[model samples]
Target: KTTNMPERPFDSENARKKQHAEQSNNELDENSPTNNNEQSGDEEDDDENQIKGNEEEDYQEDDDEETPDFTDDEYGSEFTDDYLCPELMAERPQEHESLNNVIIVDNLPKVDPAKLEKLKEVISKVYNKFGVCRNVYYPLDKDGKTKGYGFFEFQNEQMALEAVKQTDGYRLDKNHTFSVTLMSEFERLTQVPSEATDIGNLLSWLTEPDAVDQFAVQSDDPKKTMIYSNALSQPILLEERSKWTETDFVWSPKGTYLASFHEKGIALWGGKEFRQVQRFAHTGGVQHIDFSPCERYLVTTSARPGNSEAFIIWDVITGQKKRSFPVEQGSPYFK
Candidate 1:
């Protein structure tokens, strides 16, 4: 049954004709005259057409080579925001006299020793756009390679911050990038804090009575103040406040008198052995004390429960009461 029907033969002649038609269409010029009445293209037009075709091919080829984003890993991200240092976004200083305002820039373009000054000038000028730049530092080796980084000290922290935010991943030239961070971060990560021993050396002999004088009073510490006592022949602890002290302990202007608070009142201590000088008595205890500018007068305030607060001014030299004033509880010192 399968052999009963004859197979249809393939059409080779029709296929060849169809192929020839497609070739003819591909060769036709887009701007050429479609009808016989229209003008035909010349040799000059053919040359222009070839040039336009080459330009379009090159445009297509460049799409493969262009960078999408510098921050992407495709761009070797060293100079990109993705690779920025963590210290760059550090918190502000927690204390005064801190070196937090300094910005440490790293991984910069390395230049020859002779070109460092020129490079420094360029870097300074660039960072100045962000804030008031105090100084710029470029550390170099013997060969003068920029250690590949530098430091920028802004007049204040805000300027340093502006530079970090605006120019973090900013491309500096073609190869170099910035790694901006705090100088304190660098020191803390790389080294221990340096210490000064000069202070301890100067006060080494303070344990003797004759060397006694200036002392620091701490309200929170066990002993309100520390001073040299000749009796024990060593630094001795005195004026220990057994109860929780609410007021601060202060020293006289000339360091002659150490004033501390207690359950009784404010006790002023003086002498080589840190003897008791005088006690300004208050019924409930003194909460605060202030010495006049010349140390001739002292003012003490005691605020007790249920009754009016009382303030007394005392003559420092004779310990005589100068004035007494009473005011409402929780009221600030009378004007």
Candidate 2:
């Protein structure tokens, strides 16, 4: 081999490295900042065009879509305006009649609780001579003494007017004289200013921004009952009364009336003062009562004499008896 060998090209590491360096430099020039910017601009333009094309397709699809028909269908008919917005269709405000049949007797003799019944009897005897006395009420003081003032309810406005005329300034004894006046007249004399009427509105609580709810509570004491406004912080008492009911109290279906139980009858109370609105005389003594759905009538049941249960239906507004049926002790309707 040492004698005369032909010349051959040999592969070297340095030669390969030089060739790779040249190719790398050429690639760097092609990907310089100026050229990269142009490529990126073209890609951005293509993306914007694709977005616009998608938006146009979506618009066309939306335009071709049909609106749903809901008229006369089960769901549509069932959810009419009256059903969706029931409050707008609510009944009108209830009629609040005058309290003409009630009279206030002032300047009476303040007496102890022991003599209160006797005093009421004496007052009743004097007033009954003019007309039938439906009810007599004497407000009491914290010390259980009479307040020297009373309310007398008569059969009608005419009877109340007569009682006021006959008893006004009439001397009951050497110490006390009757200063009788119609409740309506007294109200007129002591009427609050127009701006102050809001203070006496029973429904004013409904305007509270918090939209608080209210509930009534009957105390362990049969005669005590309280109305409370339920608030987030605590329950606030709106009104409370002792001797408001003899045994139990109930609210009307619409929460417009409060019915109080008593041995003589059921007394319906409402309005700002919670005064007596009507009286249903159930002489047999009411044990249970129910209001008609419309609140226009009341049904009261009592244990009558001779071991029978008496059910009486009454017209709520007129306080007149509608019908009466007696169930014997063993009858199916006895309870």
Best by lDDT: 2
Clashing pairs in 1: none
**Residues 1-335, model 1: lDDT tens digits:** 36655644666677889999988876675444563224444555777899999999998888778666857665654465434755653554444224667777877878897888888887877788887777778888887687887888887877777777776776787787777777767755687545522222222335554665444445455533344334435555543434323465677765666787777778776654455666777667777788887878888887665534378899886677888777764654634
Q: List model 2 lDDT by residue over 254-317, tens digit each.
A: 7768899999889987765676778888876788899988899998888666634388889997
Local error of candidate 1 at 235, Å? Answer: 11
lDDT for 302 in candidate 2 is 82
Taken over the whole model, the C-alpha lDDT of each candidate is 0.67, 0.81
Q: Lowest-scoring 10 consecutive residues by lDDT in candidate 1?
A: 196-205
| Model 2 vs. true fold: TM | 0.37
Clashing residue pairs, backbone N/CA/C < 3 A, model 2: none
lDDT of 2 at 171: 98
